[model samples]
Target: MADGGVDEDEKPVGELFGRLIDESKAYAKAELGLAKVTAEAKAQAAKKPALLGIAAFLFLQAAVVVLCITLALALATLIGPLAGGLIATIVALGIAAGLGLMAKKALESGQ
Candidate 1:
């Protein structure tokens, strides 16, 4: 009883530490599982919107192609076919370059 004795009603230090460790491990595992489930649910919710966005992007690309073709055909009536195509291509390239530069600047500005 003189050598730092434990009381009869109290648990030993080693047993208490082991129980604490076990509970901590269980709590960590449960939290990780919950996080995984929550991430899966969020991804599932985003799927439809993501698909719709891709569809819209494709449609917009098709529209841009049609518009370019129409412009070339209309210009062909005034000029020759090859010249009209060349002019339309040059214009499209210039516009694309300007847009690219704008995007680059926006990215550099972090906006």
Candidate 2:
């Protein structure tokens, strides 16, 4: 106390408190940076298997598509006489359109 009141030249107690706050912020920033790095590593680990699963699913879809094509061809042959030649033509056109759409989808997917 100076002259029964706060000192004029003496530093405010808030300055020291401000410095402590700054140091705490710096520490928090460093800890956040570390957490970001660790989270990225964990995300990479998690993504690997999920990506693999997607690839596997895509491959399976392709295989099923191939099987579908074979079955369609076989059915087209069998159904030709039973449904008549005109009906067979319509079916063939439908199959061709379906195949065109499938190809379009494949191209769009780049797979």
Candidate 3:
């Protein structure tokens, strides 16, 4: 036996190559397993924040709807129910269209 602990008759080239390949496969499998566990942990950490964000978004949407209804009703007192509702609808649609165009432009620029 050599000081390095290898036999004086070195391993054949094919045998060494096979060992290397097996070790490489084992290393790759370990890395993949670690990555999967890391991803799962990150997802679990984000789950609560993601749910809270969705809830906040829904609440904001409700608030916007309430504001629109209030505006329509207030206008109704002055003008009339039908005309007030129409005006409110038109205003909301115009705002939505403007925001949509802005969002589209932003996305296009980012891409």
TM-score, each model? 0.87, 0.53, 0.91
Tens-place lDDT digits, model 2, residues 12-96: 8797689889999999999999999999999999998999999999999798667666656666688754455455456657888
Q: What is the C-alpha RMSD of each candidate to the true structure, in Å?
A: 4.3, 9.3, 2.5
Give the per-residue lDDT of model 3 (tens digit) for 15-96. Answer: 8889899999999999999999999999999999999999999999999899889989999999999989988899999999
Quality of model 2 by C-alpha lDDT: 0.80
Q: Tens-digit lDDT track for model 1 on 1-111?
A: 334586644868888899999999999999999999999999999999999999999999999889889889989999988899988899899999999999999999999
| Candidate with the greatest TM-score versus the true structure | 3
Q: Output the better candidate (2/3) by TM-score.
A: 3
Give the per-residue Cα lDDT of candidate 2 at 10: 78
State each model's CA lDDT, in order: 0.92, 0.80, 0.93
Ranked candidates (TM-score, high to low): 3, 1, 2
Off by over 4 Å in 1: 1-9
Clashing pairs in 2: none
TM-score of candidate 2 to 2 decimals = 0.53
